[model samples]
Target: MKRLRIISFVLSTIVFSTTLLTTVQAQGDKKSTAILDAMSNKYQKIKSFKAIFTYTPDGGKSLKGDATVKGTKFRLKMAGQEIFNDGKLMATYIKETNEVNLQDFDPSAGGDLDPTRIYSAYKKGFKYAFLQERKEGAQTFDVVELTSTGKNSQVDKVQIQVNKADNSINSWKIFQKNGQKVTYKVEQFQPDVAVADNFFTFNAKQFPGVEVVDLR
Candidate 1:
């Protein structure tokens, strides 16, 4: 019965290994979700916030921009584009074409990286893993890696670095399937900044001679 014992031992080893792997994966998933929940909880409580960020693209020049988020309303200004969303309406102005595209604000819409989608994006269409914790100077950052759950997702993976002390997102990197990488680093953040309701709406007078293209 030595052969029978050997077979039983091999089967038991395989079962044990599979269980161990599953448990480890579950623990990692729990950790990643906890980190994301902490960040979302903190940001959801904030009334209004403004942040200056540096955006760097792969093999492209870095650009500096500012984002102001107030509830579901947000305004994003970048090098060639300015996006304004006032909960109901969305306006995207492209400087190169001198055209503004207006659409109904749909949070479930894909392909755009608006400020409204930052925190909540991970909650859906993503499988997250707690990569590791990195210590830089006096700050400790919890790095979480996310892979797109959708087969047709434009982005392949995303890495988010969150400050452990303040539970704030310090930076995030987006890796596209085309091998392009975009990184955004938060330089300055001001929470509870006073913002008017009309600040998120686009005004025709502000653009001067820009053409409005309503695609709604």
Candidate 2:
């Protein structure tokens, strides 16, 4: 369940842009590439960001959590688990087991589950296209669809909704081959916030009776 949740979260993480649709082809798609590039550029400008998100997997109840990210470092907390990555090391704490798994931070590790790597991954193995425009209340959004180029990829497709006004990501949905659909809605987002380094590190002393397993 833990692994599935992490995978679903990773698959659902995406940002979109409002570039015009100029082509339908996914590979070397001019408009889609431009939109993705713009979104990536915007992300580079943010010093830090925090968001309250609700993750709902198909056939499962929704889970709420908050995440703070600074560059490649992030701290993600859900109901039973919390993951901390301080740009060099990563620790995953499981509340049920009262255990923490520590490992060296490999940018390539965790595949899509690694929050640090998702933005860049789109450029390589996927084809993207502008889907359509959508609106929710007063805010307008631009939707984009991403399809994996690899035939055997676990993710079938991903849809991202970007706020047209602020160029912020509103939400994303991931479709998996195994009939699981995971959606992540960004309820609140604050950019350029000051987050301390300590927030992304794990302190074992804080967890009494917790077993620390160092895999590094």
Candidate 3:
């Protein structure tokens, strides 16, 4: 469960942070704010998106995952488990156990377990600054730093690299107070993909003999 929570939170940071950028306040270095605004504008135009990413924790093995998101709905697959959130309920299915845990989804809850609150949490506790422009191959990236303002916050800092040409996130590294760091990089991104709303909902009929546990 702990691993699942961490993966979900990090994935949400990569996915929803881009989609919900407009809600973030323009309180940062002028350059950083401008860049963020541009990125926000670009993602706001996307009705839906699918992203493939890899995340590695400090001194830990790396794992790759994918997520499909539209509005407040998202379906994430990683580490032999799948999580579905339809802006109403959340279902976490474990393939090995063939068990699904269901719970009510609440975006207003401010915590790491709540994927939808990630952006709001960042907005509330972090301040952004423009770092520098980085070049790799033929692509240039805008590097930005987010420092935690609250002493009690678990996050020490975060560094994000945004692709200059497309205004998309290339990667992000989270630094925790315990000296642990996790890096997440986007391997692929597909925007404005056509998907039905039901894709974000888990249907029991799809998995025969699966045990459903209602935790709501």
Q: What is the TM-score (0 to 1) of candidate 1?
A: 0.80
Candidate 2 structure, TM-score to reference: 0.84
How do the candidates rank by lDDT, highest first?
3, 2, 1
Residue pairs with backbone atoms closer than 3 Å in model 2 (clashes):
none
Query: In candidate 3, residue 86 scores what lDDT?
Result: 90
Report the poorest 10 consecutive residues by lDDT, candidate 3. Answer: 110-119
Q: Give one digit per residue, the lDDT tens place, for model 1 in 123-178.
A: 66677899999999999999998887778666788898999998888888878787
Off by over 4 Å in 2: 1-28
State which candidate, 2 or 3, has the greater lDDT.
3
Comparing candidate 1 with candidate 2, which one achieves the higher TM-score?
Answer: 2
The regions of model 1 sitting more than 4 angstroms off are: 1-28, 111-114
lDDT of 2 at 135: 78
**Candidate 2 least-lDDT 10 residues:** 14-23
Q: Per-residue error at 57 for model 3, in Å?
A: 1.5
lDDT of 1 at 137: 98
All candidates: TM-score: 0.80, 0.84, 0.87
Clashes of 1: 0
Off by over 4 Å in 3: 1-4, 17-25, 110-123
**Which candidate number maximizes lDDT?**
3
Residues 1-216 of candidate 3: C-alpha lDDT, one tens digit per residue: 675566455544554533352265655889987776676667767778898899888899989989888888889998788989898998989899999989898766534313443433445567889999999999999998888887766678888888999888788898888898988888998988899999999999999999998988
